[model samples]
Target: MDARPSAWIIAAVVTFYMSAALVMVFVNKAVLNSTPDLPLLFLFIQLIIAVVLLHAGALLTPKIEVPPLDLHTAKKLTPVVLINIVGLVFNMLCLRDVEASFFQIARGLVLPLTISASSIATRSRPSISVSFAATIVTIGFFVGVAPEHTLPTASVPSGLSLFYGFLSSLFIAIHAVLIKSSLPFCSNSTIQLAYWTNAGSAFFLVPFILITGEPGNLLALVSDPKWHMSTLFWGSLITGVFGFLLCVAGLLSIKVTSPITHMFSSAMRSVIQTLLGVCIFHDVLTTNRLISLATILGGTMYYTWLKSNQPPAQSQRPQADQEALDNGDREPKVGWQAPDLDEGLNGKN
Candidate 1:
């Protein structure tokens, strides 16, 4: 008998994955808004919580094997870990300064950048259709956040938030290309790799926090009367748990759904994220931004469809493709994507 889950079960899994991915961004935004000065501290706490949860998961279930943290593996994974942390930091910074809805548009060039990075890494060019899609996304990006705007929001400084978002996209693209190089170290297991990255990030963040003087900021935040300690605690805890769940959900999503379904969900999530941003954060959704969003999503979905139809022999990097499918590139907002991974990972890995 075929043991595949029923349709409803698959639907539930996808829905849960979407919900977790969606909530992760909004929660992080809330926490960042609450403690704007402590982005590193906030990320450090989330990583610590995730690492602790991973340890607990190993103890509770034999199926979840979190390899012991050791020097050898950490050294082997240095490149991946460094890029992961950088990408995450950029992600945090971008999200911290920009409106949540604008965050996705800010990173709209991720798909194009990923394609460019992958092409350079593999020494090959993408097909015409892929190139066309990248162009559409590029056009959409320019439309949404013009470089010479007076200022989308007065509170955000000098429109550098978009620049940070662009940097985040760049690092995310680099991360996507680097994941293939690093996966072999973990025997191609996404969970195993995630364990190492999170643990390593947490370990490395201690000095980062000190070097950046976040401790002083954190102390000030605590000393201030306006901030509530519980908000930070619960926000970090909730984001940490959901972050872990989002990883699991990404894995589950790949097992039960096709690449096409995952891509559709990502587009849907973008729409919902924008709507939620408008509703909860009171983000301004201008007509130009809306058109830009639709353009980006359209180009992305079309790219995925084109890739799905390609024959197996035409695929230059199967492992990278597999990794992308196994690990969705949610990047706090699902913006970073390798050509295949970007489309596949955008749903929230």
Candidate 2:
């Protein structure tokens, strides 16, 4: 077995896991329709993936040459780093409330809004065209929102969830942009930030788990198994592998057509899941659903196109410079970078 194939297989696995998670969670009806752990979930999944990717990375290290960690050079970055942690918590909270499918929809909505918000909030002038494109996506999102997939008009996470979810996405986007912005200054900030955020989030969640997560039930949740494998087994697998895979894969894989990408796929997952539910599981799809589906696909196509074309975004340039300057690069460099475990998380928006 040549090591190269295994390396490619790992990269491919991310995409597979992400797409497969939709099927797994949907089939088991474990979609975070209400209450999912975003940060802990991210921590759980990323920990496993980091292990796999890092291990695989070592084998490929001779080939790829990942950079070494730099010391935390500047003190000014502390505030943004703190904000990143808070953002992660809110994102997790939002994820816990919504289904994976709808959560994905919320994910799609956040990409555009984050850029626009950063421009105004930070006093940075992002591209008007990108902002306009994002506006279209937002409008399309609301157009796509249907009563069926939406929360009970007055539900906690439904309307509120969407708001928080969108906000969470913004935070994440801001974090991404912020990370990329700050990357230039230190050269290690992106990876350092990732490590810190993971540890920081764990620090944050530890108290929550102790205070709120019942040790007995959690143990039971892990040890207990049923229906061929226990809920604990499946949940762990879902939480640990499937969730991480979906997210990491989405992040790592090639920038192909959005139809295949999770942005659209997440939304697509809902349609297929709903269709399967109605046809196989005998779920219902109203006329409104039919139209929403079309609208979502259309809007997603537009957003996806924007995302795809967004590489040339004139707006993110200054932010990217700020990022590279902060992360580890002593020299000036900006734009997108790859996604991976030890290094590769930070990239252009």
Candidate 3:
């Protein structure tokens, strides 16, 4: 694939990705609210669906190819997959307690956290503008989640929920760094990485779900006469399907365009999700929250712009591409760089 795709193609990929991702958030939220006790089970279902879709695509599509999940590769990716599971579980935990609007606001913390983590890991300092943008994002998250924004009728997000949200963001940030570091060991295909990660995660999550007694909750939920079987079945299926699509769409978008484009698209999705939360879920959107949202969006956009404008390190750029070629077929390398704030932001949900 060309490093720089045509403008229209990039736009189309980004649009498709954003649409799928935004829809998945709402679908997952609905399912979670309907069955609050089965967050881990819900996540496991999504992972299984993703694994099936990925394998199916690999088998059926002429162009799409997946790498084998060999023992060595699995060992390397174990940490990444584990961190991802933690992030996903905590994300659902946070979502179960907090409204979608608050969830988005709390998610704004991922960018700054990722930047900080990246800086520490790479031992390369970001520019002044980057630092400033990170600071703005941090402040925006705090302002957006302030207790003053809670309406009289609205239920405040419990302290535990807030803690989980922050912890989820931190885990995601750490995962991004690990992904960047582990790029050399895996095939350059993001599709391959996603497939194996989801597959491995499904395997890892089974024991946890069983141990946590979610199976009993699930059985109770299914047996309850008040619950409509058709509704639950279809809702869970749709959420799983959407989740699979969201993962593929995000990876595809990054493949076609640069990560900078993906980041901007994610920022757009965040804004839309926030607005939809207010309009659909009747989330309290105080003036402070609105200002904070603007700040978060503005900071992220500015950070992306700065990153794009700065030239890649001359020595590192070609070597990264060469490493991709050496690892596998001449497909575009998805591993050279991590998913950054965009993946961290959405991957949590």
Candidate 4:
């Protein structure tokens, strides 16, 4: 029984995942730009919508079963959920502040950071090629954000947005490392983990929403006669639906492709995302920023190539955990692209 997926199927899966992912970013950016003051509220609504959709899917199909949640398992998953939500908050804040074209460059260190976290987690030293690639990525990050750089008005990503991007990358890296350890609590099921993390994240968000006074902001936004309710309402709905679709697309991508193929698809997504951001949002794309993207992409691709060529024992993620990385189906969703083990665990390889 040959189990290889057909080439057309792979192409279809990659296209679906990329399209959903790209749309997710643009839609979220549109909403964030419109309601810059309500990042948490926006994210809270998306989470709720995704949760509702998951519930609906679970009820309709055997493929989408979510195990019942209990206090014991919840306690075990608390750290994962905490990391997930924190990563999400930072990602949203970063997106809220930066141009969508610059967003990927803003978070350019994700590959290297993930490598660092994975190294620490696995207690492994990356090969010289991997270390060199990390250096390239770091250099690209600096080049992209060089001091006194000029572009269109308000084009420079603020220091705060860059800081948010860094923190978001850091938390995402940590989540990638820790999520493997956190999976047994969910019976090694990514679907179950998804339910627990999203539901728990949404549940835990209420107090913060209150503390941040987003509820009041929501009221003001609603009462503002000049504001278009339809934009906010419809934008949220579209992104939420695409967010769920991104999860399913991600799952399909994983089941049908190798990490190397997935890495290439991600590279393509980054390119398309930048182009689309310019076309749709009129984002400024400076020369240095372009160089920064190419350099970072080169380094990550080199890392992926190196890791994939290594012996399977060293290069491959543990089967159970690998599934969770791509499983927007799991905790790290939208805006946060968790590097595959091929890139993240280059140290281990």
Most accurate candidate by TM-score: 3
Per lDDT, the best of the predicted structures is 3
What TM-score, computed on C-alpha atoms, does each candidate reach?
Answer: 0.79, 0.57, 0.83, 0.80
Question: In each prediction, how many residue pairs overlap at the backbone (N, C-alpha, C within less than 3 A)?
Answer: 6, 36, 0, 1
C-alpha displacement of 93 in model 1, angstroms?
Answer: 0.8
lDDT of model 4, residue 59: 88
Q: Relative to the unseen true structure, what is the C-alpha lDDT of residue 97 in candidate 2, on a scale of 0 to 100?
A: 63
Task: Locate the minimum summed-lDDT window of 10 residues in model 4.
Answer: 340-349
Which is superior by TM-score, 1 or 3?
A: 3
lDDT (C-alpha) at residue 61 in model 3? 92
Give the range where candidate 3 is weakest over 10 consecutive residues by summed lDDT.
324-333
Question: What is candidate 4's lDDT per residue for 266-322, written digit by digit as tens?
Answer: 545666678788899988777886887787688767765764464433225674544
lDDT of 3 by residue, 218-318 (tens): 89988898876675566667866777766666666656753333544565677788889888788888877888788878887776576456454333567
What is each predicted model's overall lDDT from 0 to 1?
0.65, 0.42, 0.66, 0.65
Candidate 2 structure quality by residue, lDDT tens digits, 61-164: 56322334344533434544445555545555554565433444445565454444344444445444444544544554554455554434432236676776
Off by over 4 Å in 1: 1-18, 147-152, 155-157, 248-268, 311-349
lDDT of the structure predicted as candidate 3? 0.66
Candidate 1 positional error at 194, Å: 0.9
Q: Rank the candidates by TM-score, best first.
A: 3, 4, 1, 2
